[model samples]
Target: MNYAPENSESAAAAVSAIRQMIETGKLPADGRLPTERELAAELGCGRRTVRRVLDTLEAEGLIWRKQGKGTFAGQPPDPTGALAAEIAPDADPLVVMEARVCIEPALAELCALRATGEDVQRLRKLAQRASHPMDADTAELWDGALHRAIARIAGNRVMLTAFALLDEVRMGADWQEQRHRARTPETMALYETQHRKIVDAIERRDGAAAFDAMRAHLEALSDNLRTSIRTLDE
Candidate 1:
């Protein structure tokens, strides 16, 4: 069916159509989707738009891609075993952020206690990349990766799973839009400073300091998001 979505509405409508198909079982579990070219043709949109929709769906765990195989419908591997199964797919972004505030500080503390020398170095590199991100999207991408790397350093499977699920929700289009709207060069610089502090605390093996730094960073991020939301509303 040629959808022919309007120019302004195309991206969102394309995503919605694919999601509805998946939800209604028109696209069965493990079912492979058409190629990007085919989807663009079928939806009457550009290949770039379809690709973005696919990227978003894949990030949200609604689909998975195999190398040279194709994109298929379903959840990816559960790193936390069955524990990750408890995470709701449609979790609210605010709630996800609140959960991150509760969880990430402790993870940062644990990372301080457990991080190997190499792990610390890896974090330093990630932080440096995030600090000088080429764009808002790149900044968010590296920002998420930096946090996930800290979680990995913490070396706890259950917590890792929780972090992964939260990261997935954070990658949703809505959260991405909110973050993009909230970000400014000034705010990014502030975040870079905060990120540096967190890494510094972790590298020094100061668990308490790491915890506090992470908490402060998240709290500042929450405030920034709120201000942005208000600005967008106005």
Candidate 2:
């Protein structure tokens, strides 16, 4: 893991080394990488430099880091695939929101009907995480996870694939910027409450209630986004 210098050159070298390891089958898909401290020591660099490299890799979807779990190699890109082409870099945030409003409520209804006890438990845990998010970014991440979990519990591969694609679209820089603009502390608190309502409805096995709760949550989010866009325009 020995790298070049302690400058930008070193950071680039670190990224290249890690990328090569992943590409060369040295790091299998979803395989955990060494911890930041270990990487820093091995590469003869500071933790800050390692962190910057990790951040860059994560942002590029080359890797993902869990809060406590170490970073893992991301799934390889499918550049030639329809999904990659569908979610364009400049896709409209409003279009993404509209798609969510249409699809997620139905998914929640299905989840309420189909979810197992384990699914309910996991949903509860995700809701708790969203309730106590550390910052705007963490709040958004948990919020997306909660919705995605509900979609997964619905047990429809088609809907799940659509949801996953929508998620990929959401990871775009434009969408992230728009979401960051909209995610105020007050809005996060409101979303936490809404998330609880949706989870509670699902736990009760009330499909209708779950559908309504999810629809309400997304509608509120859409409103917030509109307000944020207007403010930004102003």
Candidate 3:
């Protein structure tokens, strides 16, 4: 329970030691580290410095602090999954997905850098699970949910927020109607399969494969969007 801060007045080593604790077996995966007070006492450093390092870890999703509970470890989240409940009236559906293609590729690379076993497992669950096969109203929610999962894995809040905003645009009534009308059993099956592949590649830690898989999926989406664009409300 000791995180002895360097009394040496070096800011860098304190941060490095924190990283070492996590990287080493001292702080195992999903295991709770000592309290900030304990760490400060142990490290012989100021509480503020310890808190700062912990703050950085939280931002990276390497750790999570519960409001009433203690801090615990966390896996990285996908950065590109869109999770908005509603799309704006004037939002451009294809452009939203297109923007993902631009940002998510790099996010995937970062995911490759930072992703952990737990993160991979979550992505696997999302990718493998069958989407609800139902009417347009129901299907839209499922569709958005899966897309949002992809964003969640990126482990970057800025990226997640951007994707969420775009998802809002995608969730608009006009876009949903176009997507709903275009939803054939064949298309649904195809999307589900492609989504699975993307997750699989990410899980495998194959950066190129993951990127290509994602690209292919977006290509399919782009086609659908183009064909459905004219049908949306003006």
State each model's CA lDDT, in order: 0.85, 0.85, 0.68
Q: Put down candidate 3 lDDT per residue, 1-234, tens digits, no spaces.
A: 435644545445666776777778587455777888887776667777788878888898788787876777665434333334333433466667787677666666556555688887776665555455457666666556656766777779888788666765555435566667667788788888887787777778877777787778778877877766655544
By TM-score, rank the candidates, best first.
Answer: 2, 1, 3
Instruction: Give TM per candidate.
Output: 0.64, 0.65, 0.54
Residue-wise lDDT of candidate 1 within 131-234, one digit each (tens)? 89888888888998999999999999989877876776666436678878888888888999999999999999999999999999998888888888788889
lDDT of 1 at 208: 100
Model 2 vs. true fold: TM: 0.65
Cα RMSD of all models vs. native, in order, equals 12.9, 11.7, 13.6
Stretches of candidate 1 exceeding 4 Å from the true structure: 1-90
Task: Kindly give the stretch of ten consecutive residues in candidate 3 with the minimal lDDT sum.
Answer: 77-86
Top TM-score: which candidate number? 2
Q: Give the distance in Å from residue 164's predicted Cα in candidate 3 to where it truly belongs.
A: 2.0
User: Which 10 residues in a row give candidate 2 its minimum summed lDDT?
Assistant: 75-84
**Model 1, residue 62: C-alpha shift (Å):** 18
Off by over 4 Å in 2: 1-82
In order of listing, the candidates' clash counts read 0, 0, 19
